[model samples]
Target: MELITEGIKKAFILIFTGDREIFEIMLLTIRVSGISVIISMILGIPAGLIAGLNNFKGKKFVISIINTGMGLPPVAAGLFVSLILWRSGPLGFLNIIYTPAAMIIAQILIASPIIAGVTLAAVQQINPKLKYQAMSLGANRWQVLWILIREAKLPTLAAIMAGFGGVISEVGAVMMVGGNIKGQTRVLTTATVQMVRMGNFDIAIALVIILLFLTFAVNLVLTLIQQKENITWAQRFWR
Candidate 1:
């Protein structure tokens, strides 16, 4: 009761007072998650488009792998990334362990599959006839692909939101790879965990509040874009 109230108060203080450390954590969280989602979109959208629209051998196997990746555990991703970034590991030459770069890498791994899976589903749901119609009209492969992508833009936005949400809220993998160093790789989620472990429930709750607010803000913008697109699409359909 008191704890909750105190935490709420602290959250407002931190937000309104513009606490430097809190702001840094918030920015880092956004920067890491933002970059991760963008990279994931670049990688995932193409992979999903290719997998969904094309026919080839072992397509089912490829899709199965993507589906599996969508549900991959954060801890497992962390372990895998940690192994590769560890001093004795294969990619140790880069020496990015415990850095923001490492956190971004882990987040990308966590987010890309989710975006890809959702995108794959979205593209698959499109009417196949559209592709044939475009092709018959002399549209080249690239043009056809563009048209299909435009058609799926709304759902693709949803995929981006999902990817952003996944990585923004993630803790385990980032914590593992980033080592939660203060003023460096510390992010909202990892910082919250640190506060909790230190029995600073008020601070932890404040961090949680900030995180929820951040998530809501980003998703709200995305949702607005999505709904606007929906209305535009409906108008076009009616006309």
Candidate 2:
């Protein structure tokens, strides 16, 4: 209990005093996690939209695969990504096995499936009559699909934000792929681990505090989005 109290006090000081180490870790965490979410959105949303609207022989199987991947173990994702970047691996020529790029790749693998699965679920929740209503007016297939996507915006945003949350707080995959190099790949989670191991409790706790704040901010923003007041796009989505 004493150790816990001391750690919390030191953590508060580091944050209040604006420690450089804590700032750096916070910045890197935001950068990598933000980019990872963007990458997942670019790939997952379209695929999920297509899966949601189209009827293909293997479509169910493909969606099932994505749903399964949504829960993929982070360490396994780390190992698979690490191998691809290893010196003797197929992508070894890039020589980026233990860099931010590697960490981004691992995060993309972990988050993309989640985004896709959630997007698919959201799309599925929409009434079939909505699509039928659009098509009845002589709208083409693309038009109907676009209309559905617009309507499901809120849930889709929630899915993406959820993926972002997961990636930002992730420790295992980033550490394995980024190598947690100082001033280069040392993100919040990795930095926290190193600080604790080295008995630098102040910095570790500070990083954790920053992480909590950022996560809280993200959730608060998304929660506000839940009420589609000024979010007219989401309003259109809900209908």
Candidate 3:
């Protein structure tokens, strides 16, 4: 109880005082996760759309791999990324280890599968007849896809939220790839770990509080946007 109170007080102090380091860490967290999520959307959305819309040979196998990747262990992802970026590794010539770029790469790997899987599920849930109907109505391939996608927009937003949530809360892969370098790649999650390891319990709690608040703030905005078009029973009070 005492620790909680002290930590809350400290968190207020840090936030109100505009602590540069804390703010920087928070911003970096947002930047890395945001960029990674965008990249994931770019890469995953197309793959998901194709997988969901088409029934080709080995499609089930591809979907199974995507589903499996959705639950890929963070530590395993970290190790895999580390190996690929290691000094003597094949891609080491790019030399982006222990940096924000590396963290974004790890995060993209972590987030893309979740995005892709969710997107695939969303698109698949649409009526197959809708595609044929649109085509019969003289809609081109692109137009048909657009209409189908718009129908699944609600769940598509959910996929985006899920992807963002996954990467923002992730710690292991980012830490492994970023090395948590202060003023460079130190994010909220890694900073919390570092604080705990250094026995700064109060500071650690403060960081945790900040992280929770940050996550809440970002998701709250997303939630608002998501529910904007379709108010749910639970959202009645908010409306």
Candidate 4:
């Protein structure tokens, strides 16, 4: 209890003092996770929409694969990315290992599937009649897709939140690929782990607190957007 209290106090001190190391780690964590989630959104949203809206042979198999990926282990993702980025490995020429880019790639692998899976479910829940109605109105394929996406925007925001949550809290994959190099690739999760291993419990707790604050702040913004959208949608329905 005393340790936790002390840690909480230390966290405030670190934040108020504008500790450079902590600030840098927090920023890197946000940058890596933020970029990963954005890329995942660009890739995952379309893939999910295509998979959900289309009727093709082996579609179930593809969805099953996505579902499997949604639950992929972080360490496994780390290992796979590391292998590809390893010297003498297939894509080793790019030489991104042990860098923030490598961490972002690993996080994208972890986050993309989750976002895709959630988006798939969201789009699939839309009424089939809505698509038909839009088609009857002479809406082109792209127009219909846009309409459906708008209808699913609320849940898509949820998918974004989930993706952000996944990548922000991730440690194993980032650690493996980034080597947790200070002033470069270090992030809150990895730093927390490092502090813990070094028996710096107060610092570790501080890192965890900062991580939680980041998570909460991001999610709070997402949730506000979602609820505002929901309210607007409800108003439209009532009209």
Off by over 4 Å in 2: 135-143, 233-239
What is the per-residue lDDT of model 4 for residues 1-239, given as tens digits with 9 covering 90 to 100? 98888877887888889888898998899899999999999988888888998889999998999999999999999999999999888989999999999999999999999999999999999987898898999889988887888889889889999999999999999999999999999999999999989987877877888899899999899888777744554356474
Model 1, 93-181: lDDT tens per residue? 89999999999999999899999999999999999889999899888998898788888988988999999989999999999999999
| CA lDDT of each prediction against the hidden true structure | 0.90, 0.87, 0.87, 0.90
Error of 3 at 85 (Å): 1.0
Superposition error at 18 for model 2 (Å) = 1.7
For every candidate structure, what is the RMSD over all alpha carbons to the true structure, in angstroms? 3.1, 3.0, 5.1, 3.1
Inter-residue clash pairs, candidate 3: none
> Candidate 2: minimum summed lDDT over ten consecutive residues — where?
228-237
User: lDDT tens digits, residues 57-137, model 3?
Assistant: 999999999999899988788889999999899889889999898899898888899989998999999998988998999
TM-score per prediction, in order, is 0.93, 0.90, 0.91, 0.93
Any runs in candidate 4 off by more than 4 Å, and if so which?
230-239
**Residue 46 error, candidate 4, Å:** 1.0
TM-score-superior candidate, 1 or 3: 1
